[model samples]
Target: MEDLKREGFTLVNGSLGLDLKHCQLVLRKIAGYHAASVVLHEKNPKCFNNFLDNVYSTDCLDDFGPVIRTIFKNCVDMISKWPGYGTYVDTLRSLEDTIVSHIRKANERDEAMYNVLNHGDLWINNIMFKYNEQKQEVEDVR
Candidate 1:
């Protein structure tokens, strides 16, 4: 792993609401990373086959199901205590049983479609950005 901190990159924690410009910069870099991976895979088809093996398959999701549900429940509980958020809490609680399955389904790769290297667990905390001199523009990402 790269020492992003040493490179003056910083990650925005999940709880903080992300501004549109920061979000855009992060997404643009992610898209570029995905695109670059695709090109690399095309150039050396055999090199990427090892990575194509499903490390996060349905069985793996099953392993994480309880943990996922617990986190979901915690989120629901947190929101449940908040005034005027009852509707959202109810919706989240109702989906607890199926959320893991839904995620597993979405993660199922379609062989017919061209697949690139997927950043499987991407979240706000996993991305680090480096800003310009004024700290107003994101110039690099990791």
Candidate 2:
């Protein structure tokens, strides 16, 4: 792995929300990364065979059900007080039983469309940005 710090690149704090400019830069880079991955996948799908490691890809993280339920409950409690969101709260409660299956299906790689391995969990720390000399503008992202 090339040393990004030595090459003048920097990482942002994942705890804070990125500014619109940085968010745009990160999106452009992610889009480019996905586009390149699609080409690589089409040329050699075997290269992606070992990349099937997602949270919902297996039952290993099934223990997280209570966590998910609590989150949904908090969501419902927070939204139940909204003027016109009572139905939405009920809907969220109703999804507790089948949401995990939906998540599993969504996490699966769809080979029909020549699905490339996705880096969809795009957290702030997962990206690196290089700024200009004065650190005013982002020069590149990785």
Measured with C-alpha atoms, the lDDT of residue 15 in candidate 2 is 78
Give me the displacement of residue 26 in model 2, in angstroms: 1.0
TM match of model 1 to true structure: 0.69
lDDT of each: 0.80, 0.78
Candidate 1 backbone collisions, by pair: none
lDDT of 2 by residue, 1-142 (tens): 9999998899988778788889888878777877998999778878877785767787754877678777867877889999988877877888877776777777777767656556767787778988899857877888
For each candidate in turn, the TM-score is: 0.69, 0.75
RMSD of 1: 3.4
Best by TM-score: 2
Give the Å error, residue 71, model 1.
Answer: 1.1
Give the per-residue lDDT digits (tens) of candidate 1, residues 1-142.
7788998898766798678887787788779878998789779878986775563554877888899899988989999999999889878888999988877776676777767787877888788888887856877777
